[model samples]
Structure formats: C-alpha cells, structure tokens
Target: MMCETSDGDPGTDGGAAEAGADTGGDDVDEAGLAQFSALLEDSTEDLYDNAPCGYLSTLMDGRIAKVNSTLLDWLGYTGTQLVGRKRFSDLLTVGGKLYHETHFAPLLAMQGQVSGIALELKCADGSRLPVLVTSVVKTGSDGQPLLVRTTLFEAGDRRAYESELLRARKEAERARADAEAARKTAETERARLHQVVVILQKSLLPPELPQVPGLQAAAYYHPASTDQLGGDFYDLFALGDGSWSFFLGDVCGKGPEAASVTSLIRYTLRAACLHADGPAEALDMLNTALYARYTGNDPRYCTVVAGTLTPRDGTFDITVASGGHPPALLLRADGTTDFVRTPGGMLVGITSRPDFITSTTTLAPGDTLLLYTDGLTEARTTAGPRYSEEALHAFAHSLAPAGARQTVTALTGLLEGFGNGLDDDTALLALGVPAADGVGVT
Candidate 1:
C-alpha cells in the first residue's frame, strides 16, 4: 500500500526514482563547472609566474612582498630569499642603487608612476644585467599609497649598441682634431716660404737710386704676385769720370729661377758698363753674356733698355740703346712730348748675334726722359682691350710739364686704377733736368 495524500497519484515509486535522477544530473553539471574553474585558476597563476618579462611587488618601505618565478630566475635567487629578506633596490648594482634613491624614487613619489628607466641589476653570481624597468604605485580606495608593482625587460643588446655608438663618436672627435692640427702646420710653412721669397726678390733689385748732379730721378717697381718673386729689375749708378749709367729690364718667367737670372743680368750689366765706351756696346756685352750662359733647350731671354748720361755745361748728352724694349718718351719744357724711337732691335739673349739700336738726344734744361717695361702697355682695361702703346703715349703727353716725381706718382695712380688688369709686374724710371730759371719741370 503506497499511500496517497490529497490529490494523490498511484505511482509514488516511479516519481521518487525520477526525482533521484534529476539530482544526479545537477551534481554532474556542478562537477564540470568546478573542474573548469580550477583549470582557469591554474592557468592564471602559470601566466603570472613564468611571463616573458620579470615582475615583482614591494611594500611601501621597499621590502619585496611578492616575486614571480621569472624575476627570481633572472636574479638567480630563490623565492624565499627575495620575498622575505630582500628589497627591490637590493637587486640593482651600486650605481643603479644610487640612481634609484636619488632620482627614480623621488620622481616616482611625485608622479606616482615611472616608466622606461634604464638601470643595471646585480645577479647572485656577481654579474650585471642591463634592463629597462617600469613601476606603478598601487593605491587603496582612499587614495593612500599601498605597494609598488614593477616590470623589468632585458636590455643586453641595447647596452652593447650604446657603447659602440660612444666609441664611434670619440674616434670622430679625434679625427677632427688631427685635421685642424695639420691645417695649422701647413699655414705656418706657407708663411715661412713667403718670407723667404720676399727676401730673395729684394736682393735682385737695387738698394737705392744714384743721385746725378744735374738730374732729378725717380723709380718704382710693382710686383704682380705677393707670394712669388718677379723678373723685373732696375739700377742707376755712376760709371766714373762724369758719366752715369742706368738700365731697366724684364726677364721671361717668375720665381726662384727667374730671380737667379735677374741677379746675373743686373750684375753683368753693371760690370760691362765699367769697361764699355757707349750704351750700345754695353748692351752688346750683356747680350753676349746671357746668350753664353743659357745655351740649352730651355733658353732664357729678356728685353732691356740701357742708357748713359753726361752733363756738359748745364746740358746733358744722353745716348739710349734698346734691346726689344719699348721706346723712350721725351717731354720738353714747352709742354710737348715725343717718342725717341729705337726700332729694329732684337730681344737680348735669343741669338748669339743680336741687333740693338741706339738713339741720341740732348736733355736740355727742363727736359724729361721716361723708360718703362712692357707691363704698362700690355695691361688690360676694364673693356678687355690692352692699355696699348698709343694710350701710354697720350698719357705721357697729358703730363708734359710734370716733374719726375709728379709723373711717376700720376702713372702709379693709373696702374692702381687698372686693378687686376695689370697682370704682370711693372718697372719705371724717370729722369728730368731743372729749368734754368730754377723751376722744377718734367
């Protein structure tokens, strides 16, 4: 008799069996959920302990409260050793510890977070590990600081790269310093060589112009280049027995070789004048000497104008000779100018037998004679044409009544005006006789 209550059915045994089956199904479902929850917990713990980077948690006073397995492995310490006894800064090297205390801690205290701080850590085996660290301060609900959570990344390769960069920068600095030293040495040597060239160039020219009794004379020399010696030279000296001799010449090239030839020619001319009777003979002797000295394939030559002046009772007897040189200008006291031409003269030292022409004139009272090198005529104007011989003639005519000093001063100013157009060096010599009325006219 399975009893029935109010509104009862007659299958009580079957209903009880059904209720038991429902309870078993609920138990099975609950067991599956519990298994899944346990698995998820285990995975979360594994992820935190064995992550790619290091992790640690510290109390407010910096004592290590928790440490992951990965951090313990990098520092070569057991969890028990670090979690209970060590602080976070204890894993850093001496320098890193000092930096953390002075800068990193203060910055973190003010900002509540610090990231990407470069630091070096100390390992248990007495080695260093370069790392970049980031840290955040965990706060309670009331905004009170509670603990610090930190993450570290390995930076061995980055440290090596920075060291290499520093080495390269040092090498570049040394190279720059060496180059500057070499440049200064070169400049000093250049200055010394320039001084030597200047001394040699001065030796080739006359020390001073000789004073003639009845003549007022002036001379000037202009060098084209400041660094190298030039080939132009001039000299005026007494040749004994009421006779005065003067010569002006230009050689072919410049520098030490040209300077040597210039010296030889000047001395030869002075020696020849001591023995020769007239200007033409003296020039002939100079031509013979130069031709004999340079008889090789590289022949040396020059253009020369030699002259002699002899005072005769308030008037002077002047004989001029030309060796392929420009014609001399004669300026009269009456404000007229003419060229004392010596055509058909050959360049000296070109051939063993060269032709030289001679011209004679009496430098009466208030007369002037002017001689110059080809640099004056060959100079270029701003319009690109040469300052021709005709132009020089006209210029001399314009200064007809100028004295030697005045004429030279005016011509020098003209040369200055030419600027860079005067490419070659110039030599000028001017001689003038005073008027009988004590007037100084060219």
Candidate 2:
C-alpha cells in the first residue's frame, strides 16, 4: 500500500536525510579550508622574524626603518635600539663603512640594486661578523624609490677558506724566492772555486820554459776543462853540466791527487838529474821514488818521455828514455818523419825495477823533434775513429822541414780544431836546430 505523508510521497523522508548529509559535507570542507588559510596567515610574520638569513629595511636617507629578529640577534641589538636611531652604515665596521659609502651606495643608486657584497658588521659586543649582503630598492606606485631592502648571509666559512688560499699562495712565493737565492749562491761558490783551481794548476807547471842555448824550443798545454787540474806537464831547464834536461809526461789521473803526483815527479826528476848517469838512469830513479811512495791500494803511475840535450857544433844530441810513453817524432830537414819508439818500456811507478828504453837521435840543422802526451793521438778528428799515432806521423811528415815554433803553432791550430772532441788534457814540446841562416824555417 503506497502511503502518502504530508509531502505526498513515502520516500520524502529519505531524500531529506540525504540532503542533510550533503550540507554536512559542504560545511566540513569549508571549515578545513578556513583553518588552512588561518594557519598560512599566522606563519607569514613568523617566517620573517625567524628566517634562516637576516633581513632589514632602511629609509632612503640610510636610516634603519625596520629589522627582523634574526638580524637583531646576529648584531646583538634590539628593535628599539636600531630602528629610526642608526643608519645601515652604522652597523658596518670601519672598512665596511668606507666601502659602503664610496662604492656600494653609488652603485646602488645607479643600478637600483647591489648583490653579493662581502662586508663585516660590528656587533654590539665589539666582535665583527662576516656576511654576504644583497640589496634592492623598494619603490612606490610612481616608481620613486621608497626604502632599501637588504639580505645578509653568514660568510664565516667562506671568508676563512679565502684566507687560507691567500696564505698558501704567499708561502709558495716565499719558497720560490728561497730556491732562487740558493741557486745564485751555489753559482757564486762554483766561480770562486774555479778561480782557485786555475791558480793552483798554474803553480804545478813551469812559469816559462828556460832559455836553451843554440836550440829553439816551444811548447803548448790545453786543459779539457777550466775547473779541472790537468795532469799533463812539460818543462825545459838547464842542467848543471852544460846540457839541458826536458820532459813531457802524463800522470794517471786529474784533480789535486794527480797534481800532487805530478809535483813529486817534477821535483824528483830535477833532483835526480844532478846525480843520475843518463836519461835512462834519471827515469829509473823516478820509478824507484814512485814505486816506494805509492805501494798501496791507490797506486799512482805515469808515462814519461825524459831526455837530455847536449849541444854540438851545429846540432844537438837527443837521448830520450821512455817509460811506456808514446814514441817521440823526429821531423827531418829532408821532409821525412820517424818514430823514436822504445817498445819494451813499462809504466813508471808500478814496478820496483821498471824497464825504461832509451832512443838516441840528433836534431841537426833544420830538423825538429816533437814530444806530446797521448791526448793528441787519442783525440777524435771527425766523430769517427781516434786521431791515431799513424795519422799523426803522416801529419808530421806533411809539416817536415818545419822548425819548433812553426810545427808547434800548426799543431796548436789542429788541437783547436778538435774543439770539444779533445776530452783529455794535452801537452806539446818541440825542440829544433835552426838552419845556418838563423831563421826557423817552416
């Protein structure tokens, strides 16, 4: 049975209940939205006061208008203490104030904004706080500037990092300067030591060859390095018996140790000449002295060509004794050359009874005898084989009919041509008998 109520239908009460449910849902939604809007409104002021960074506003005349709690806390100031009483520059330290007035203000005026300026603010407690500041101008409706809005970020860590980089740069520069100073000092010391070596080396050799009567004598010495003391040496001095004694030799090594051996050899040879019978005896005495003096692990030895010159009526008698030295060259007037070789001689100073062979030759009119250290024969000619003894013999043959001075001069030019290839010290001694016309003929 369909029953009609006062609204005339039986489902009228159910429809009224559903409509009430819809009204309740709408009211709940409105209430939630209202609550959310209220919360957002409440957070606006809180967000400004307790923001992560500092914020402030200043009047166009630079006077502080308002400052957030964050800024006040960082600067140790109160709202009442700073607002309307102090300018923005008053919060800055001395240098910051200068920069703000001279640079920041003018730039902001021209561009209407400034950003990322590093500055220091003086706190109320006298400590300075580093900050990176950014600022912009707030304008009115007519585009006229009203106030300045500025933001400050803490810059302590960044400032410290920059300071460390600067310190490191300065330290590197100091280290480089110290290194340059040390290098210069070392160079100066090397120069001084080279000078001393030069003086000491000169002392080891004869100042000049003594004058030989009736015979022309010439010599040359070249050291491979300016600083090293060369072991090659030569000398011509008059003996007490009217004959002259001359020697050309090379010690085992270089430097002061070899120089000491060379000094001993020179003095021993000169002293032995007074009592020794001949050139061979003089070398024997030298061998005995060397063997006795250096019999240890550091044995010293030398190769020598020692000889006596006895003047004849128109020539000189040459008696040369060799102790493992290269044979002397005899350049004759007839454009011929011969080696006065002593094949069986041993090196001096190594044996108690060393063998020394003697070779006799005469320096007749327009003839020359050339004596040299092995540095000459061992030199390189053109980056190929060594300048062998055979080549030198041929070379001397080409310079035959040459006198002492001319041959020596030509050989000097040859040695110079070797340049850096002559790695050893060289010594040359030439003895010649002049032609009857009295000029040294080349």
Count backbone overlaps in model 2.
0
lDDT of each prediction vs. the true structure?
Answer: 0.85, 0.87
For model 2, residues 106-154, the per-residue Cα lDDT tens digits are: 9999999999999999999999999999989888999999989998998
- Show where candidate 2 strays beyond 4 Å: 1-55, 66-83, 111-117, 132-143, 151-154, 332-337, 379-387, 390-403, 409-422, 434-442
- What TM-score would each prediction reach against the true structure? 0.77, 0.78
Local error of candidate 2 at residue 117 (angstroms): 4.2
Q: Which ten residues in a row have the lowest lDDT in candidate 2?
A: 1-10
Clashing pairs in 1: none
The number of residue pairs in model 1 that clash at the backbone is 0
